[model samples]
Target: MNAVIRTVRADEWEQVRELRLAALRDPVAHLAFLETVDAALACSDDFWRERAAGAAETGDGQVRQFVAEGPDGRWLGTVTALVERPSAEVRFGESAKVDQTHLVGVYVRPEARGGAVVEALFRAAVDWSWTVEGIRRVRLYVHEENARAAAFYRRFGFAPSGERVPVPGGVGAYEDEYELLPSASRDAVTG
Candidate 1:
């Protein structure tokens, strides 16, 4: 699938909201996302506006959201990179031991899965993460039951980092940590 991968614009909050809602409704959303469709729907427009603005290209460099836009102008996929520092509040799992970026909110439209769109989005996100000063690695968490996501991440060179976080509200369930060191990412993408 031909797609244009770019950072989301602050003014495109509506499109962002629509895409997120769609992701939340996917069949595997229970394993892929932490938030529910009902919870996301309960959020106000201002909430979405702030989210979009914070991740937009014009916002602070701490966060960036990349979207794969189809030829028809539809958002086909998205992935966000968030710079994490030891001193900053942890958004998930554990506090950072070294400078790194966490990949989150990953999604691809049903029709766009198993295509180049997802790879393009990951390439864009990982490339953006390395641009941040002092970033040594990129990381993301996947539910243990979500084999499809885990497989893709493995193919992209993200290996288990030996850290696990308990899945919220799920008894005995966990999300395993996967990390990609800077050098490994380069080799993974190019080799």
Candidate 2:
């Protein structure tokens, strides 16, 4: 697909905002994302500016955002990794209870699926996570009904951690936590 997977720059907040909005509009966004389109659209420019900077390549190393850029320069997909600590307050379902990272905001355009784009994006994300010292593993959460995402995650070597988060106000839907430990080798192995 001739895509470039790289960390986003702080000055590209506009592109970041646009790509996030595009992700929110995808058909499975309800199952894959926590924020609504309207809610994301209502966010001020300053919020996006901060968000972009926080995950930018030049920002602190605690959080990193990677994007798959198409040949024409538009983003095809995006993902972010945030460092976590056992002593820190739980940001998602539960405290990691160990030094680790959580993967979030995963998105890939429908047109870009069934190729190496998603795998490339994940390789970059997981590679960056392992570069951080003392990191035990990388984690992510998928809506139980989002079979496609869960399948991809499993193929990428993440397994269920058995910790679940109830979808707030939802009837029975839940988010299943999955994790991957950085291997001594096999960084590119996705099965």
TM-score of each: 0.97, 0.95
Q: After superposition, which runs of candidate 2 have C-alpha atoms over 4 Å from their true positions?
A: 184-191
How many clashes (backbone N, Cα, C below 3 Å) per candidate?
Answer: 0, 0
Candidate lDDT values, in order: 0.94, 0.89
Q: Which stretches of candidate 1 lie over 4 Å from their true place?
A: 189-191
Q: For residues 136-169, write the lDDT of model 2, one tens digit per residue.
A: 8999999999999999888888889999999766
Error of 2 at 27 (Å): 1.0
TM-score of 1: 0.97
